[model samples]
Target: MHRRRSVVLTALTALVAIYSLVPLFWLVVNATKTQQGLLSSFGLWFGDGKFALLDNIRQTLTYDDGVFVRWLGNTLLYVVAGAGGATLLATLGGYGLAKFDFPGKRAVFAVVIGAVAVPGTALAVPTFLMFSRMGLTNTPWSVIIPSLVSPFGLYLMWTFAAQAVPDEMLEAARIDGAGEFRTFFRVSAPLLGPGIVTVLLFTVVATWNNYFLPLIMLKDPRWYPLTIGLNSWNDQAQTVGGQAVFNLVITGSLLTILPLLAAFLLLQRYWQSGLAAGSVKE
Candidate 1:
């Protein structure tokens, strides 16, 4: 009876896995087709034979003066700069909050906790107004600056630092004549590797998928990121008479996801190691 129950559970889990992946499977199948092929092809598989995937890619690049590549570059810039800054701020701020006792420390921590409860969307209008007053609207800095202030990332780092870095080690380094900055860089920072990677990944994905901020800040299509660029294609699809861009949009979407997938695969091992290290403390 126990073995029979295990078999049933395994079959159910397999079914759920297939159900979740079916859309991705369909997307891969359709992205290879031409616009005509996509219109006629089965939603779940290829058409009569095959369509020109290379031709589709060529058109996607050549269309709109190769704006897609520009958008991709913009996204890279945003992700790297914003996420990098946010991670640095989170590491230093989290370390400070966790290890030090300063004037109004409790009040400062209370503000951080309150910030974590606030949503990014809620701050958009206020940020826009502030930038408008300073004439910073329609600029990349408008988005990148806000991306650096991630309360949730700070909270995660604080929790992780409190657990991962020990005060005893820091004190020992001080005894050895290392300055506070040197001790943080040469000693405590290395120990917080897993936490840093975790926060970096979170900040990267958040900045990459950001839409509303860019939508309000960027008025020029040349400055648009993939999210905004794809949204333009989707809007065109809605208003235009044909599905000429159906394949291009699908293919563009697929390409946009590759970097994120690469990031996760590259950092997953670090994330796992960090979690395990945090769990098994000496």
Candidate 2:
């Protein structure tokens, strides 16, 4: 009976996995087809195997004065500056909150938790207003500065640090004449390895996928990220017939997902380990 139940569960999981991946599979298959083939071919199956992927990619990059490349560069910049800065800030903030004690510590922690509960979308209007007042509304900084404050990432890091980093290890490092910062960098940082990767991946993915803040803050297409760029393609698809932008949109979506996929694949092991560490500890 137990074995039968296990088999049933496995089958259900497989079914769910396939259901989730079917659209992705279709996107990949369709991305390799031409505009005509995309419209005519069976979406789930390979279309004509004539290898239009290179052509599609070339056209995608060349479209609208090479706007796609600009968007890609902007996305990379946002991810590196926003998410990378967020992760570093989260690490320091989380480490401090987790390891140190001072006046109003509980109040500070409560504020961190409150910040996490607030959705980023809810802050977009206020952020835009503030940036607008500063004359930064149309610049990349308008999007990036807001992205750097990842309250969720900070909370995750705090939780991970509290559990993963041993006080004894910190004490030992201190006894050997390491400063608090040195101890954190040399000892706690290494032990928080899995957590750091988890936070970095989460922060990077979040910033990379962010649309609303950029939508409100940026007025320039030249500084738009992939998310906004795709939205532009979608808008053009609504009116432009000869543009063949529907195919471009679909293909561009497939291309846009690759970096996220690569990031997850590269850091999946760390995420798994982080989860295990988090779960097993509690």
Candidate 3:
């Protein structure tokens, strides 16, 4: 019976993996095909067309005087500043909520919870209006500022810090003449490795894939992220006289995902450890 269950579970797991990977596999297979090949060929397999991947990549990077490169740079800038800031603020906020006691503590938790419960879409119009009033619209700061406030990230870190960092350890640190900042940096920070990486991964992915916010916030093509840029390329193909650059779009998409894949591969260990710590009860 146990062997039967194991086999069933394994099959289900395999199915889930395949389901998750099919689009990626399709993207990889299609990225190698030319525009004509994409139209004429089977999606899951390579086409008879000459491998235009290198050519496509060159075009993607060099087209319109290398606008794609600028978009990529803009994306990186947003991810670094937005995601990094979100992680920092979440960590500090979460740690404070977990360890420190002050007035409005419960109220703060309620506010965080309420914020998390509200979808970002609901806040988008207000955010836009506020930014426009501040004259931050069409600027990188608009995107970065909104991205910095990650309620979910803060909540995750709050739960993680509460469980992972013991009151006893904090008391001992205090007893040892370690300053609050020093204790956090020297002692608590090491233990927070998994949670920090988890929050970082979340924020990074969110910032990297952010489209609607950047779409509404930024007007300049120079400040567009890869998500919006790729969509523009896709949209161009839709116009009556627009250039058919699906091959470049596919290749650019392939290029766009590579960094995220690398990030996941590198940080996967910490992410898994974080899940473990977050899941199990003491």
Per TM-score, the best of the predicted structures is 3
The residue-by-residue lDDT of candidate 2 on 1-282, one tens digit each, is 999999999999999999999999999988888888877885689877577888888889898888998999999999999999999999999888888888998898889889989998989998888888899998989988998898888898888899889898889998999998888878898778887888899899899999899998877888899999999899888884744877788889998999999999988988787677667733
lDDT of 3: 0.91
True lDDT of residue 7, candidate 2: 100
Q: Could you arrange the candidates by TM-score from highest to lowest?
A: 3, 2, 1
Q: Estimate each model's TM-score.
A: 0.91, 0.92, 0.94
Clashes of each: 0, 0, 0
Residue 206's C-alpha lDDT in candidate 1?
94
Leading candidate by lDDT: 3
RMSD to true structure for each model, in Å:
2.5, 2.5, 2.3
- Candidate 3 pairs with clashing backbones: none
| Candidate 3 displacement at residue 247 in angstroms | 0.8
